[model samples]
Target: MTKGYIHIYTGDGKGKTTAAIGLAIRAVGAGKKVCILQFMKSLAYSEQKILQSIPGITLITLGKPYFIAKEGMLTDEQRKTWGNHIRIYPAGHPPKDYREMTLKGIEQAIDAVSKNYDMVILDEYNMARWYDLATEEETEKILKARRPEVELIFTGRNAPKEILDAADLITEMKKIRHYYDKGVPVRTGIEN
Candidate 1:
């Protein structure tokens, strides 16, 4: 059997989840079964709609309707506009329900890795761990559950050193410049 390696797409830039989805399409095109578990994300993303209909792909999303932001990640006006749709929490103190949900997603991830999938993508999982919604040990458990022939991918920012150490391939999406800096809100087809 062919060996499958671990890949991590991380950093403060955008396109982490996009890269994972691209890979999923490539894998499916190659006649491989792919499973994607989107952590800390709801079905609000337009890609979720298309990903669900693709052959040889299974998509699972585990998140609340609202999104989470760290304190100071947005301006007062931005927060006001996103009020009720965004939860801004301090470091090391994520919302309890979100944490519970992440743990449950981890279980589902473990199950997916143990199955017959050729590739499994844990989208936004690094950010979930960075936000303290999940633990390194729990992430490692999902890593350990993977079959030898199943490729694993994790995407999001601030990936812990432990995760970087375990990865066979790591691609960091550095943000040299972004239109969002000029106050461009997330566009539906591009960012959301």
Candidate 2:
């Protein structure tokens, strides 16, 4: 292709990452190289097992093993149930180590954009910025480094205004309803 544009998949609903993955698959099918950098996520997701083996695709996950929630985002009962599997922190004070790890991941993304990758997906990047794991200025680095032929996709909820403005296309998945609210857990290969 001669030119590629930026795309953002945001909002509280699901399918943001799914859309990005679909695009990656399409790109690969067309003989294009793809790199997916998942921020604030670990390697436990089932998709990673297959994505890692896909030719012409590079998958990198940057996150701790445990989930993280901003203080007050989770109910007391929820916290109790999660126990040591989740970490809750006060607003504006996310874990320093996590933030540092993401910053390095941002650098890797920037480098990937500079390389020959035809498409780059920054999964959960919106949440990373929302939770202060990454800053808009750091995001700017990847934007600035993007080649004209490199497509960039950012996925996750609560995309900041700056990100929305910078995107060539934006798709917000508004949740009309979800089974999770009805006490369903995230099923593997679907919501995980």
Residue 124, model 2: Cα distance from true site in angstroms? 0.2
For model 1, the run of ten residues with the poorest summed lDDT: 65-74
Residue-pair clashes, model 2: 0
Lowest summed lDDT across 10 adjacent residues in model 2 is found at 87-96
> Per-model C-alpha lDDT, please?
0.92, 0.92
TM-score of each predicted structure versus truth: 0.93, 0.96
Per-residue lDDT tens digits of candidate 2, residues 1-192? 689999999988889999999999999999999999999889889889999999999999999998889988888899998999988888878898898999899999999999899999999999999898888899888889998899999999998877788899999999999999999998998988
**Which runs of model 1 end up more than 4 angstroms from their true locations?**
70-78
* Distance from true location, Cα of 165 in model 1, Å: 0.7
- Candidate 1 lDDT, 1-192, residue by residue in tens: 999999999998989999999999999999999999999898899999999999999999989998788787899998999888999999888888999998889998999999889999999999899888989899889888999999999999998877899899999999999999998998999998
